[model samples]
Target: MNIPLNRHSPTPIYLQIRNYLSRLIQSGKMLSGQKLPSIRVLSTSIQVNKLTVIEAYSLLEADGLIHARQGSGYFVNPKTTVTSGLTLRSNFSPSQEVIISQGGGSFFEQYTTSIQARRQQNIIEFSSGFPSTSISDNLQRVAKRALAKAGDTLFREDFPQGQLLLRQLIAQMLIQQGLEVSSEEIIITSGSQQALSLAMQYYLRKDDWVIVETPTYHGALGILKNLQAKVIGIPMTAEGINLELLEQYLKSHRPKLIYTISTLHNPTGITTSLAHRQALITLARQYECFILEDNAYEGLKFQPVPPPIKALDRYDLVTYISTFSKTLMPGLRIGYMVVTGEHHQPLVKQKLLNDLHVSTVSQVIVSEFLASGHYRRHLNRLRISNLQSRNVMLQALESYFPDAIAWTIPKGGLFLWTHLPNHLPIQTICSEALSHNVLIASGAAFFLGQGYPAMRLNFCHTPEDIEHGIKIIGRLIKNYLTPSFISVGLSSQEVSVSSMR
Candidate 1:
């Protein structure tokens, strides 16, 4: 093996040696299953201390790129993909997050694994993006009425554009929110997810440039990856997406779409200010780009919220979407989007090609629920319940979480984004929390490339579990931060107590 040692550099000699060997393996210079030089030989060959060579080999072994037998020298791990010039994993992981060089790495794989693990442990998802269970009774009542109304047409499918009555109701609701649009412009979808997919399918082509708010909605990011679009994420401040930065991107990239959940944004809990909304609309018009406004968390605000960006879209530049999933019930699978202009016909046709139409029975139920004003009453009750639940979560976070941890206090939404200390190992924290049967949504899943130490905590679904989970998680973080943390993890008795709590 030919290797040069740089003694004057700031990087540790062990790390440098590890990196050189890593490059050789990655570039296929070192074949898989090939033995590395013996520690004595390499140490003498490089004129380095044996300890430095040992440390380098140990690091490589930990990376799964190499292995050692009791008697044999280190050999490259045959299972590695480095021989083919592929990385074993993305830079982002549950344990340590590094800045992404490119977007569209598979975040769902890690995220879903965490969820499935929690389910195996029978963990009630406090980190669920779903709404509070308190509305189940009201939902059942409306569902029955809807089923009765759909007795004959239950088998008959609605048009490709969706059930007209539901669209009319959605149009009415949007009008009240100051977005003037006729029912003809609206298309009912299976859910906000489908609506988003339809829009991306209609307007975006492979390799298309798309702009989105940093740490926006995870679902939208997932969709963007499926569509094979190049995603540009604009970091958001307390005010909202940085307009100055957005303008720079708009000027440079002129992306075809700007996808955002401007109202009580998912993960972050920020509602873009009305002035910012108006500015964004103007920018979209100037750049001839379309704005896809995902208002999934439109209502449930603790206070009067700003109007959606769609409301200010005078040039028909904004495609507005919202759903009953967050406000009412998710099982309904009913959502709608108002789209007109050039993209209208294709979206309807594409939606038809996808699903003939959203569930007819579900749409009928939602229509009656909305037209009878029951939805309004339900929304009021929902706001109160969610507000109380959010407060419970906030208090728990404030009381139990470490001082190094900071979190958002969204005015009204199911999520509170918690930012962990940068230097801490998020992967270890996530693993420890799982031992306690608590789950958290990794913040990395929501970003295009914004790798940071954070996770989104859901407050509505597990209101009762907030205090308990927070207590357990707080203790775990404390232990990990202290000098005594030795990965001893939680005791079985301790885990059982947590599960009981």
Candidate 2:
């Protein structure tokens, strides 16, 4: 594998090596179990410092891409394949055909396939609503510091509700946002996804109706469908979820729960206004229903974040869920929920059965980080970075894509929802783009039951990478729309374009 050495470039030499090696491994050019050149040999070949090669190799090893031996060089591990695939086996029956008539089982398959396929490719992933790796370093450092101070005591089982310190920290955090939450009200879970799952388990019964946004987070959609809940989707507008339609659903179908992302809504990057929040809260109270507010993207906001729906909730019906995944780190998987009114006990019980509690070490570390002033400083840095990246992606999109493709300019959050012209087949475009070496998430995965012709592009993960990837996408779209190009099959060069696009 040849890695271009750019001494004049501002990028660190090690990162250049890391990126080159990562690309090679991802493209299957460097097979699993293949040994990378020795650090000395690499340093000699590249004419860089030996320590630079060592640093790059170490970084790659830490990322789970390769393993080091005492006497031998680094070798790619077999686990890389599974890690790259990101496929998890579900306990549910695999034979359940994913047909539309089969009650959304097939829809789950499409979601899983999109995620797994993206993981397998080397594309700059704007499809996932996850934080960039730079944010994770702070969390990791916090965890390490906690371990150094606490030692082996952290290995023991923690309180069923999670560490008290973390709970208190979470409570204080919520209070600052104008919610009068207590430590007892917060229940720690694996992540926001688990928090949502716990809420579903506590409230949803099979075939019970639930109201969700028309195109929502796929994971939430999957969980609700897995629970066998009859989901009624209210179409989202620039203002957020249509309150009138939501009320109509409440009146007509009497949904038990209304799951929403009010603050910096996912996939579409639209936040519900204060008026809409109050309206939804009032409607929930009027209908005597629960509002599961997923505020996962709350902290990632570039603009002043709006008050959460829970803050406006007076009836004790809003179950507020948020996580450090987007703001801090996704891998930490630390999420908390605030349950109000009479639902606290049952929800806590459901959480206990699901995973007993979130990791105690994670809780303590994150809590300590919050108390240390580190979290605040890190958040400041993240906000600036996110804002810059968001601007970069927006400019790239506007410059590269066709005028027919419309997108929302989100105030904050990782995603930008783009809609193709009505006649354009998103799946076909995605498939055709894949053949050209550019990968994009099809819009259909975001829908609850049927697919749509829109795609959610995450803009904050890698701005420069997104720029290059979108250029490929623009080129591919242009080719697809051209009648002359349609007559000829895609070539190998076109496939490369698709993969990167």
Candidate 3:
């Protein structure tokens, strides 16, 4: 392995290595079925992170130039078509254009600004993804009890993997849900967002191909863009992710990872069937790719749903991430992931470098809360309240919204995915709604490619607010559709909020 890296080049070191190897394989210098240097040996010879070498080899594998045998090193694929290999443009990458060109602001930036702007305006917001519940008296009591029990341990540096007690409780909860994970395998983070960041940083490098659901969680899209990974969006169908398109991408692209929200998916509120779960697991196994399953809203569902893709994973390929923010207070920010095998040590190291660990007080309190069984009781109450709120919103949409506008009836979760007529742009609608003191999430924020005319409305507000908000949005759409309004070429800014009120 005589590959050299350009310290001045804009392209990543991993891609540089991958390109060099690809050229060799295609040019016949590396023969078919011949073993290449092992990851450890090659990384030592080149003086780079082992993960970087792994990434380069993984890309070569994805390009069909090589294959790996367990307990053995990677080898040139015997049946590879040697056509100059996958080309890397000299001065361009898709990620450089993805964030700035698609939509300027990220989901976090947009919603944070929205929250601040509306803090004094008393705006009823449908843009939030979590239930806005205050800390209960019982939670306060639990926190005090946890503090009392902390003794001197709270003052000392704790494990990077997080509080063991919290992990044990989480493992028990997961066991009830059908996953065979233990406390040692779990790593606690500030939130599921941090967990996602760790996994992405560990597995994905620049120009690596990854698959995601179109209209997926905007947070994940933001992370992928930041990491400079190429994303392919597979549309969500009635059951789950479009398996047909997923498999096709698997065969042709050989993506490194599949990111999915299997149960109580955000924005759309679609849960896949058991068979759909099985098929997804099978596809990932056949393709020899990993799956990052975000089950953030799993606890919010009203009906019974299938176990997570992790529970069905026989090959230890799925990385399961979830958070207590959706069920508990969002400020708690306690999330965990179950990692096994080679990925564990690296992810833990990344976690240590990222923030050391989640807040000690937050982890301790949550641990005590779970141990006391208050968490289950809180979930039951939350489900009932959210269900009532959802029903009210549905009724309001039926009464105030036009027949042309449609929305999904979610079994559980905070959002209702609404589809607007293709002729209308969601960005204009969101801006006009904001002027009227109603904030909604424009669907444009959720896509990596071309976005559709849709919006995600949260059902976590009061019945009165939900009805009033829906009515205002419906009126805005109706006004936009009116013949006189359209003929006059009235802009969204020209629409009078006073008249609507």
Against the true structure, whose TM-score is highest? Answer: 3
TM-score of 2: 0.73
**Stretches of model 3 off by over 4 angstroms after superposition:** 1-105, 482-501
Task: Give lDDT tens digits, candidate 1, residues 1-501.
Answer: 668878999988998999999889878889988999999999999889998998787656534467665577778865311123322221111221112222455456755664474556467465567775454565687778878877889888679998778888888777657688898999988888899988988779998888887777777777888888877777666667777768877887778988888888887887778888889999999999999999888766766677788877777788999888888877789888888777678889999999888888788888888876567656755665666677777777767876556666687878778766555677787777877788766676776664556778887745568778888877877776643322222111111001110
- By lDDT rank, best first, the candidates go 3, 1, 2
lDDT (C-alpha) at residue 277 in model 1: 89
The lowest-lDDT stretch of 10 consecutive residues in candidate 3 is 88-97
Over 1-501, each residue of candidate 2 has an lDDT whose tens digit, in order, gives 457888889988998998899778867888888999998888988888998997787556534466665577678755311222321221111011111211234346655655675665465665666766553565577778877887786778876677887888888767656677889888888988888888887888998888787677878887877888877767776677767667766887787998898877777778778888888899999998988999888876655566788888777888999999877767678998998879888887777777777776677778877776456556655665666677676677767877556677776777778766544567777776676555676777777655436778777656668778788788777755655433331211111101110
Q: Worst 10-residue stretch by lDDT in candidate 2?
A: 492-501
TM-score, model 1 to reference: 0.73
> How many steric clashes between backbone atoms does each model show?
2, 15, 0
By lDDT, the best candidate is 3
lDDT of 3 by residue, 408-492 (tens): 7777888878766656757787889989899888888887655557789999888899989999999988877755434323122
